[model samples]
Target: MLDGLTLDQMRVFVAVANSGSFRAGAGKVARVQSAVSHAIANLEAELGIALFDRSGHRPVLTPEGRALLANARDILLRVDAMRARARGLGEGVEPELSLVIDTLFPLEQVGAALTEMRAEYPSVAIRLSIEPLGGPVAGLLEQRCQLAVTVGEDFRDPRLELRALSAVPVVTVVAAGHPLARQAEGRTLAISDLADHLQIVLTDPTPLSEGRDFGVISPQTCRVNTQETKLALIRAGLGWGRLPLWEVERHLAEKQLVRLASHALGRSGLLVSESYLAHRIDAPLGPAARAFAQSLMQLSGPRSP
Candidate 1:
């Protein structure tokens, strides 16, 4: 009974059912209306069922046709996925590219690079993680990710291969109404001025950087796990802290936050931290991973080491 069943017939049937007319389905499937009609007729004959009711002006799916439509769609989807995966395998592309990026890295650049990667390698699945401090390096070390974009210069591990990506400007910021902002109108505040205020610090969740403190000047401190939480607390005038300048540019422009003039941070109160593209020296980059890494480098313009 299923002797005449073919993918072409099922495709035409599904197209006609979805389009509600034989002519439209023919156009959709890029075949003539006669071919579409012939395909549907063969499919219905093979299945021994009336797939469509032709009594109406436009064809309507029968109960049996409605029931089979979902199966047809699912089959097509699986076939497409199979073809894509097979193509990727033949071309030596990785099945998936897992990447872990430092939370301080600009998301806009990441998004742009991903957009390009998707267009170039549609079959290669992406697994992305945004982690703070040593979390990114930990993911790479634990084999959770194949590539990592990390901030700072603490990556001295011989197991990793690093390439300088770009420098991100870190700036100390406080809410416009914070006491420090009000007191430092035209003068640079000394480190002693910040000692009393509760500095909302981003703490590393991983033991890889347990004993390290980056740019912490406050005696009274409030530790947070995520940058978003720290930013929220800072916006609430609860404390002051250093954040990537790109992250707080909008708030600075809107007058919601004010940049602190710190004598420790020199004249501009900006610290440029180098971010790097890292991967294990032992694990060679697959095609997809290499492509994505190239895209990131192109987007950020790789810095001279």
Candidate 2:
């Protein structure tokens, strides 16, 4: 008997329960009141359960109907999603978008872009990875990710296409109580002044950038893989390091971290790190991937020098 139960019957059942009347449910499903009532009656008979109580002026869901309403709604929603996914595939939309982003890129911008992407392509799944230094590029080269956003202006790889996104300011900072912070109070510190202090630096996990160090002036150093760990260690007064200004702006404003002023930091103790959007030259982006890329570009605005 349950094998005879149909989706139309479930739909009519849910519609009547939600609208609280057979006539309203019929209007909701574009069927007449008699047909709606008949579908509900068939559903109830098949399950041998009283789905509605018609003892009152308007129909009301019975305890059994209430118990199963959620399951019925879930099934309808999944079917809708499956249909959307099928339509998207037929339209050449990618089933999934895999993106790897550099740790230096502002997370807020990434979140905003992804939010837009989700609204525009709900059927496309997203796989996101946050990596440091060479990791994003490596993910692209290895075909582990379909797209990448990374820092650095120098991508000489012939197999990849790179477009400038924006420039993120990198600032040298230390805990408010660190010795370096105290040293930079009166006057600008010289390059030699940092030689004695332990510098915290981010290391690339991939061999693509193995043994290569960026902006390492201090002889004594602590190496970390993630930016958060480096920031935490620096906040603890264990060391000083260069971090993205966007990441530490609040700390700097709250007096938790002090920006270092030094002649060694060329250009007012600020370094402009250029970021780029990258992908393989061999593989073009699909509809969903292209939409996501456009979203990122639009949200990021004009590239900063």
lDDT of 2 by residue, 172-257 (tens): 99999999898989778788998789999998878877657788999999999899999999999999999988899999999999
> What overall lDDT goes with each candidate model?
0.85, 0.85
Clashes of each: 0, 0
- TM-score for every candidate vs. truth? 0.68, 0.68
TM-score of model 2 relative to the true fold?
Answer: 0.68
Clash pairs of candidate 1?
none
In candidate 1, position 212 carries an lDDT of: 76
- Lowest lDDT sum, 10 consecutive residues, model 1, at 80-89
The positional error of residue 72 in candidate 1, measured at the CA in angstroms, is 60
lDDT for 297 in candidate 1 is 89
TM-score of 1: 0.68
